[model samples]
Target: MLGTVEERVQSCPECGEEIRTDHRFVPWCAACDWNVDPGEPEEPGGRLEALRRRLAREHGERLLAEVTTDEALRPRRDAASVLALALASAVHGFTVALFVGGVLLVVLGWGGALPVLGALCLPIAWLLRPRFSRLPEDEQVLYRSDAPELFALIDEIGGAVGTTGVHAVAVNGETNASVSTYGLRRRRLLTIGLGLWEMLTAGQRIALLGHELGHYAGGDTRHGLVIGNALGSLRTWLYLLSRIESPTAPEAVLNAFYLLPRGAVLGAAMALDHLTLRATQRGEYLADSFAARCGSTEAAVGLMDALMVSGSADVTLLRESNALRGHRGAAGEAESGLWDRLAAHTESIPASEYERQRRRGALRGHSVDSTHPPTHLRRSRLLAVAALPAAVTVDAARGSAVRTELSGARKLVARRILNGG
Candidate 1:
């Protein structure tokens, strides 16, 4: 809370329109939306992106139509999932073959003629091995000892979602949240962006948790190490090969060596993504269903609403960052309540603004990105059916304790954001 902010009436400085706001919040004319940006309009990524958007829109519309008649409860699979599984397995098998081939070449070449070839295989095998994530250096890591109440709430939500809770949590000053595995042990980590987390209500927070964890419950093969690492390795190969531009005669000769391999890798990467794209989309929808189950339909819808406004929140951050430049002056302070202002920015948006965003989303084929289904379709699916009560709840006491636990980290994040880090 921004300490019980009181409404003050005023005229918009730009449009001279009537406006209202509190001390911590910026006043903007409803007509002009001077500072309130739900987000900037999305730029088309390219031709492939346009095609993906069209496909996603069509698929999402069909799925929403399906959800209207079908009860939205447990997730279901389809033929696309089967195809995706087959393709994922094939990629993993190929990686395993690379290891076996490399090992055998080295072993056989120990006393054989192809010693040079065998040595080459070893590097290739190691290069393409399945890899997982590493803990982020930029984000603050939280342990159970560091924030017991927060982890307890996470545990409760995980249990509600039917997966073990995260082994650790990391907080950063971005507008995103994600679940990823780190280290050789592959222990689960939940990364929460305080920028987004700070703006959400308790219910919306639950929905966020459920949606990320739901990726687990839905068995998101796209995210699993099998397909994830395989596609990742292929991408790495593509990146490396792409850098070999033929600027000189010698470079051209060398580039020719990798040209065929790059094309092959690109084709392989596209196939993997193409085969799995639908399944990935399905996993997202399933995750949202889990979100609805754990956070209740109303809150899940609010979560979608939050995502829709994320770009604006990003703009708010920049706006605040620039606003602080004169005062902070090359040295940012941790004491400035940048987050309180961010939270207030969200608070200042009314229901009518949200409604306008929803309408715009339909015309825009609103999506979080190219990977997921359109937000308008996702929201419509939720609204098409009646929602059960939230399975997990964080009452006021729990919420307060969690906030208290995060107080230090929140201050650190605020300092980082204001400092232009």
Candidate 2:
């Protein structure tokens, strides 16, 4: 998902105002007291199951066909490639034009009526430029020499995928693994979730790493950076415009004139972004296929199942955070027991029932802004790939050593989380 569940916003059809409702099924607008169909409240599990069945009936056949057809599965870079270059050029050109135009207007002393207006606007654009700066590394723990095992695994996965190794690796508290770029250089950073590592088997772990590494091999991260920065610039520009304080009527009128064109430009950027969403989704499928090649189909499937099973990590963390209140130093110790608690909870649920829930969860689909395809769609695509030879198994000793290394990393992560870093 693009954001937290609580962060999901809905627009009221009647008022066209954003509404923050407690329940998704019952979207009630706080502004106009607008209610959407006011149907009987359905249990979360029942809703998920219904969604799963509905999606299967609607999109299952088409998804299966797309996955099975080799041509359909191929990643088409022509559109995304062109769009990325065009977007980068447009943003750079616009900024440069703003600065140059401002300088010329000031130097020529043209239009006393609009004296230095361009010069004044230039500073605003430059000030807002920081907001479009390259994404920073958000992980609390930066695992370089500290996590040699992970670096080695990343290198191995990079070799398997025929790409240069990652620049750095880090761990987070989430239940997902992702590859991202930082700064203008677009240096790669691979982030793995401690919770996900605790849940997956050795083969599944390999598959997960392979999936992330596949993004680099497929150029998804590079293209994504272009789109991401463009969107970021648009958002920052919008935010700066919105925050412009119009203390007087004249200032309000002036701000409105300034914002009007920028707003149109923002709208155009959004439309361009929408056009590339399909390419982003296809990149995900390509990555899945790459993972299937690196690891066996079984390993890829296992990784997907593990993802479904452990998707509740957010909820678990929330509960743990509450429980950790007033127990400051003991947070790391509390965290150490989380995996065991989760394992026990999983065991308490019957295997058949767990599978059913997992299948249902997969059908709920991802949020609109998510770049990855829905879990159900990805799972289907993996199933369509022809079976490959078994992946090489890690030796028991090596496996044990990797787990030991991960365990150490987990403690560090736990400490970081507890200390509120």
Tell how far residue 111 is off in model 1, in angstroms: 10
Cα lDDT of all candidates, in order? 0.76, 0.63
The reply for model 2, stretches above 4 Å from the true place, is: 1-64, 71-75, 106-115, 127-144, 221-225, 243-263, 326-333, 343-349, 352-363, 366-370, 390-392, 418-421
Per-residue lDDT tens digits for candidate 2, residues 1-421, read: 1123343467889899986543312355556655522433343343223433343345444644765687335555676568666875687567677777777877777878444697696786685353323343565444557667667767877887768777777777778888877666767888888777666667777788888888887767235655555555666666565635645888778687877776676665555555555556667777777677667778888777767666455555556666777877777568777666655544443343344434454434442124456666677778866766434356688787776766765776766555554
Model 2, global lDDT: 0.63
TM-score to true structure, per model: 0.82, 0.73
* Winner by TM-score: 1
- Clashing residue pairs, backbone N/CA/C < 3 A, model 2: none
Clashing residue pairs in candidate 1, if any?
none
